[model samples]
Target: MKFLYRILFDLNKEIEEEAIKEGIVYVLNYYKNEFILYIQAYMAEARWLNNNYQPTLEEYIRVSTISSGYCLITATCYIGMGNIATEDIFKWLTNKPKVIDVAIVLCRLMDDIVSNEFEQKRDHVSSFLECYMRQYNVSREGAVQEGRKRIVDAWKDINKESLMPTDVPRPFLTHIINLSRFMDVVYKDKDNFTHSEGEMKAFIKALLLDPMKI
Candidate 1:
């Protein structure tokens, strides 16, 4: 597992370097900084757990949850930055409003999984979809529909705001959809070893790539 962790860390560094070379430096830096903070937090939690009680499956889940939360945050940041940077060299949205929304939801899902409050049979999709739905104050089905709608709407808004209409292409949108699909598949296969370290490294690499290069 230590070897696997090192491989993942090295792959993450490579991805960050790639993003920086492509002029998405801020995104890579932001995520890398966040990851460091998360690691510190995880270490602190582990120390407390070690001192206070016997290690259990629950403790293991907490550690995994922290790692997963960091992964999702960094992944989303990479995607958002890569998308914005691909089209315009200097035209970047510093706010990243949509990405923030998604991150909050993803974090909540991670929390539920870590705390053992998420029901595999009943709450997986519900918890995942809740982020968008809660933001819009809509039902689960409504939220799913709204989430898709917002993605399209956001594209249009970006087109209007950027003034370079053709800069961000449809393939970028397709990539995001594909990424969401992959996340769904992974969540569904949580019981199985569906994700390998190498696969995750590849996914991060894909996210870090410039859309034109991809």
Candidate 2:
């Protein structure tokens, strides 16, 4: 983390004027506060596991939104080299657009759907599956079926955002949509990310290890 801070410090020097650099530092500090709050919620979830406490669906979703790490990805992707983004665009995104919200929702729900089985075997926080099952008094299969429906709904929102009348740049919006698609592929059958010894491993080898015949 210290290395990351050093990189940011060096990056600030790339700005032409000291005033703009200082302003950027101030903005970074603001984002630091936001990140700390987000991480605190995740840590609180861990602490809740000690008591075997179950969070409501609302509570679960709220925390999952932050823990999904979409906020950091959106901030970096949307505010590019300043040509495609401006102060107005950044301010608009600060309000949290619908597309980004749904994209992260897709990520959190998909991850829980595929990973909750393994996660439940250990002392883990209450996932969406647990919240839904407890809330509705349903079986695991039932809860998963309903969770799949919500995932479909989130995709619809993502599709709508990708269309016209967008508040942010289409390119920025595409990055979020692509992230959802990538999550779908990754967590389709299992938690390929956490357990990468199967198809994901082969994929990595093909993409990175095996050199193409040039």
Candidate 3:
């Protein structure tokens, strides 16, 4: 198990560097393959969980495999972004050193969304992706605009009351607010983007090896 973990870690680091030099196309493809593998493993675990009997060794292996996939995906994102501290994040991603910190926070939020139990809630992956996209802004008629404001406003109010005034930037706070709204749509939607076997293979190829068009 340790050997496998080490191998995955090393492979992830190499892929992360390549993806960074490439582009979002490569990153997206890489994540898609990882996501598919994890989902398959998760399905096995879900079946085990639904059975009347206790989990067997095989079931445990399935769960662990799923978890390893998740860990690799998370590591890839962190490594690709250069894994700077929250305070120094802005500097790493920007010339003026201001965007990195906010990007870090956004990455954390994205991680949370991915780790969330959306499958249990009967939510779909496309919905979650849409929610992540909306983290940048809010719309008036969308799902998030309906009731997400309350949760976001309350969180902001609580933070304001508890933290020092200088601890949080207004722009960052605003980003969180928008992110909250986007997540609402994700949590509520059920439709997922469907891909054929060929499409999936193509996505993997684009992500893992095609540096020219990453």
Candidate 4:
């Protein structure tokens, strides 16, 4: 954790160097607040676990979406985006824009869907599946089936948001969309990220060795 803190602290210099506009420097302060919120999201989940609290689906989504780290990654990605990421763009993202919101949701759901069982076995906090099943009085499979439906809907929302005309640059939106897509691929069939030695490694190796015919 200390190493992580040091890296985050060092990012101030890096971000300042990469940022050109004076307003971008001011926005860096705002991003620091985002960093705080990110940590708070994780702390909230820890508190829930410590108290043995079972969050409602709404409550779970509110926190887990932030805890998913997609928003933070989006912010960090934007901070270094040279000039396209202007002050207004940074402020807009800080407001939790719809495209980023849905991406965060998509990521959290996919992660929980694939990792819930393993986490449950380890006596971890209640995941979205458990919360939904408890509230809706459904079985695990039923909750998962519903969850899959939500995932499909999330993809639709992502596409709609990205494709529609907007003020934010297409490249910035691409970062959010691509992050969600990455989550889809990583957690679709299994938690390949956690077990990266298996499918993840093989996929990387193949990608590096194989050339695209197209």
Candidate 5:
């Protein structure tokens, strides 16, 4: 525990020094708070696992979306983003506004759909499928069907959110949507991230090697 505490201390000290040098100290607490929420989310999942406790879909989503780390990732994206990443933008993100929440929720459900079987083979915590199935008393396929339906609904919500006029800037919304798209690509029909030898390799090659046509 002492070693762990020292490592955490060193990480914070490093981030604080960098943030100060970059004149972005205003985002430091936001980053730290997001990390705290991320850690607490994992701890909640662990406790549920240890106690053999099953959460309802709503309860599971509440924690799982934080565990998705989208908020933390977004905060990290803003750390050195210069003038555009105002403190107000960070505050907006921290409040868990509707659009970003839908994005991460889409990410979480898509991941669970593609990864639940492999996760279940281990001593992992119950995934979204498990929670939904348990709550609704549905079969595995039924749960999957329902999960996909929710994902489609989330995408519809995201589309509506994007099309409507809003106070938030477009870049931030686009960035969050990009993160969701990444999750969708990596975990759509399979765990493409883990089994990266095939399509993922091609994706990288296309992204890096093959130049775009003009």
Candidate 6:
């Protein structure tokens, strides 16, 4: 953990030591209140393996939300995207606003759905699909249907947040929306991230390598 902290601090030191210090303080404060969350999330699958315990759908989703890396992504955007974004706005965003929460949920659920088939072939963590199946005593097909419903509901939350009046600027909120859209393509019909020998590679080549005609 110290290594991770040092790397983050050094990277930010290029900008300003004070900024790094403030970022550290923010992360420490966040962890002080929510440190147990990481443990619970990481240990979820271990508990399942040790005791054959399958968490309820709500339990699974709640814990899975933390492990979704939304907090890190949102914080990075606040600092990186906010060259002109004020400290107050960045602080407001780091407070886990509605838009961030919905975006995180969208990420978590869709990832689980698209990665379900691939992950099952290994000794992977118990996905939301497994949890839902055990909780409701449903078959794989039924659990998949339920999982799709939950994902759709998350999208509804994102759409509603997008339409509603917010204290932050639209561009900031759009960053989160774009994140969900990116996940859709990355994990659509397959877990392209983990098994990235196909279209994702082509995506990288086109986006980063291909020259555009002027």
Among the numbered candidates, top lDDT falls to 5
lDDT of 5 by residue, 52-137 (tens): 89888888999999998889888877775755788899999999889888888898889899888888998988898888888889
lDDT of 5 at 93: 91
lDDT of each: 0.47, 0.76, 0.42, 0.84, 0.87, 0.73
Models 1 onward score TM values of: 0.40, 0.81, 0.26, 0.90, 0.90, 0.78
Q: Cα lDDT of model 4 overall?
A: 0.84
RMSD of 3: 13.8
lDDT comparison, 2 vs 5, better candidate: 5
Ordered list by TM-score, greatest first: 5, 4, 2, 6, 1, 3
1-214: candidate 4 lDDT, tens digit per residue: 9998899778866776666443556666767778788899899999999999999999998988888878778888887676667788888888888887777878888899999888898757788899999999999999999888988988999999988997787898888888887897799999998989998888888779775667
**Poorest 10 consecutive residues by lDDT, candidate 1:** 87-96
Q: Model 6, range 1-214, lDDT digits (tens) per residue? A: 8998798667655434444544533443333334345556767756766786767778777878887767656655555642455666657765788877777777887788888888889777688888878888899889878767867887898899899998888888888888888888887677888888999999998888995767
Count clashing residue pairs in model 1. Answer: 0
Clashing pairs in 3: 89-100, 89-101, 90-100, 90-101, 91-97
Error of 3 at 196 (Å): 13
Q: Residue 205 in candidate 6 has what lDDT?
A: 89
Separately for all candidates shown, the number of backbone clashes (residues 3 or more apart, or on different chains) is 0, 0, 5, 0, 0, 0
**C-alpha positional error of residue 14 in candidate 5 after TM-score superposition, expressed in Å:** 5.3
lDDT-better candidate, 1 vs 3: 1
Question: How displaced is residue 95 in candidate 2, in Å?
Answer: 1.5
Pairs that collide, model 1:
none
**Candidate 6: residue 5 lDDT (0-100):** 71
Worst 10 residues of 2 by lDDT: 16-25
**What is the lDDT for 148 in model 1?**
49
